[model samples]
Target: MQKKAGVGFYVFLVIFVFVIMFPFLWILLSSVKPLSELFGDQAFTWFTSNPTIQSYISVFTIRPFHLYLWNSLVVATVTTVYTVFVAAFAAYAIARLRFRGKAIILGVVLSVSMFPQIATISPIYIFLRNIGLTNSHLGLIIPYTTFALPLSIWLLVTFFRKIPFDLEESAKMDGASMMQTYFRIILPLAVPGIFTTAILVFIAAWNEFLFALVINTAEDYKTVPVGIGMFQGQYTIPWGEISAATVIVTIPLVIMVLLFQRRIVSGLTSGAVKE
Candidate 1:
């Protein structure tokens, strides 16, 4: 029975991986296919007789894809950094300190994160317009950070709670101030959690569509996701160019996940396992 179950699990895993990877594989293959072959009357197939780099070149030349890439990087990086830094303090307080309404506050934060961006877009748009922040990176960054904060705080708080309280008490005994202990002791120990939270925040900000679209309306400030969506050829959508753009944007994320898979796994599981 155990042998049969193990074989079943492997089969399931293989199917799951294929399902998850199929779209990405399609995008990747389509990106390299020539326009003639891509749009030919022949039924679409995985095989392409002629592949060209024209789609990739067009992605950059036809639109400000480079600028869009830069905007995504800047916005995602800044939002991740600021959100994680701020959430660190909030998470630390919730994890280590005894205070009134802490549970309520944490619950509210989680609840806020659960709200879809669609629900908040109208008010957010009005606020940005009123502040004259529309069409600017700062406009997008603010909302991105706001949305990312709850998850960041929740993850960090869970990780922080897992840390031994004895280290904190020892820091206090050694004449460290509260801030000093946080900076010197607790924060260092929570590096894994911080990194994991940062990556999640960065990815969220990177792929965010609605907030990026509504907040940054100008070509100069648009992110990759929005820019890619704009690949239209008057008559129809440019599938080849869109595929290329997707492949380009997806590569970075794949590389990041591969490079940090170990740390991400460790950080994610570390807090979940308690004695």
Candidate 2:
């Protein structure tokens, strides 16, 4: 009975992983296929007999996809750095300091994130337009940081709270100022959490579409998502190039996650159990 249950669980896990990975696998296969195979009678075929790098080449040559990628990298990187920095301070205050309405403040910060992007996009667009930030990297960075903050703050707060208060007390006894303690002690100990938060924020900013689409209509400021959307020509949709672009854009994120997956898991699980 035990053996049978274990076999069933492994089978279930395999199926679950396949289901999750199927779309990416399909897209990858599609990316390598030539346009002929893509539109040919065997278009629905899972395996392409003629695999070529033409689509990948076309992704760069046909459109300014590289520029879009650069734009996304800049915006996401800036957003992640700024968001994590601000959230660290805000979270430390919430986690360590005694203050009034702390719960209410945290709740309000979270509630801001819950507001639908669609609902707020109009006002946000108007504000950015008035400030002459539309179609600029700063425009996207600002909004990305805004939406990223609540989650960053919440996660950092959990990590900060998990830290022993004795550390801070000792730092104070050693004549460390609040800033010194925060910079030297609290932030250092929360490296895993900060790394995890930064990754999440970067991914969010990278994949953001609605605001990127609406605010930055210029070719110069277009991100990967926007660039992929514009891959369609007047008469034909370049499925091959779209797939190739998807694969290209996705590789960095996959590599990032795989590289730091251990830290991510550690950060997520660190504060779960009471010390």
Candidate 3:
């Protein structure tokens, strides 16, 4: 009976995996097809008549895809590092340090996350403009960190709070300073939470479109998503190249998340289960 249940579960999971992956599989296959062949309505299949790498090359030559890739990498990396760094300290403070109004402070930060990003755009635009960060990577990074930091803090703090205070007390009794204990011990134990927050923030900054479009005017400053949008000329959109670029851009992120899947899942479930 139990074996039958296990078999049923595997079957369901197989079906679900195919359902989730079919669209991406379709996209990857279509990306390699020649534009001419792709346009005509034909029964969709895994094969294309004239699969070529021309679309991929055109992305680099026609528009500076490499430069845009660099831009995105710089901004995403900076935002992730800054968000995690700030969130780590803030989370530690809230979770372990004796402080007044910790609940209220943390609650306010969480509440801020509930606010729609669109609501903050005007102020963010004006602020960045005044600082001459508009059309710059710093502009995107700053706002991305701000948007991601609150949530990172919440995730890390929640996870940290679940950890027993005994370790911290033991460290303190051994004459290790608070900062030393935090940096050496507490931070190591919270690896899963940090990775989890980094993944979330990385995805947000990597995929942010509206802010990227509004803030950056130069081709050099645009991210892959915004740069891909520009592939649509006054006359046409290069769906083949666009799809190829999409696939290319998505690969690194997918790989990173998969590599860290266990830690991310552990972090996400740790505090929620309280075990």
Clashing pairs in 3: none
Q: For each candidate, what is the lDDT? A: 0.87, 0.87, 0.83
Count of backbone clashes, every candidate in sequence:
0, 0, 0
* Deviation of model 1 at 218, angstroms: 1.7
| Model 1 C-alpha lDDT per residue in residues 143-212, reported as the tens digit of each score | 8866889978988988898899999999899999999999899989999889988887788888899998
For candidate 1, the clash count comes to 0
As for candidate 2, its clashing pairs are: none
Candidate 3: C-alpha RMSD to true structure equals: 2.3
Regions of candidate 3 where Cα sits further than 4 Å from its true position = 1-9, 43-45, 267-275
Error of 1 at 209 (Å): 1.3
Per-residue lDDT tens digits of candidate 2, residues 24-136?
A: 99999999987888886878999988889999898788788889999999999998888889889999999999989999989998798787889888889999999999999
**Candidates 1 and 2 compared by TM-score, better number:** 2
Q: Write the number of the candidate with greater lDDT, choosing between 2 and 3.
A: 2
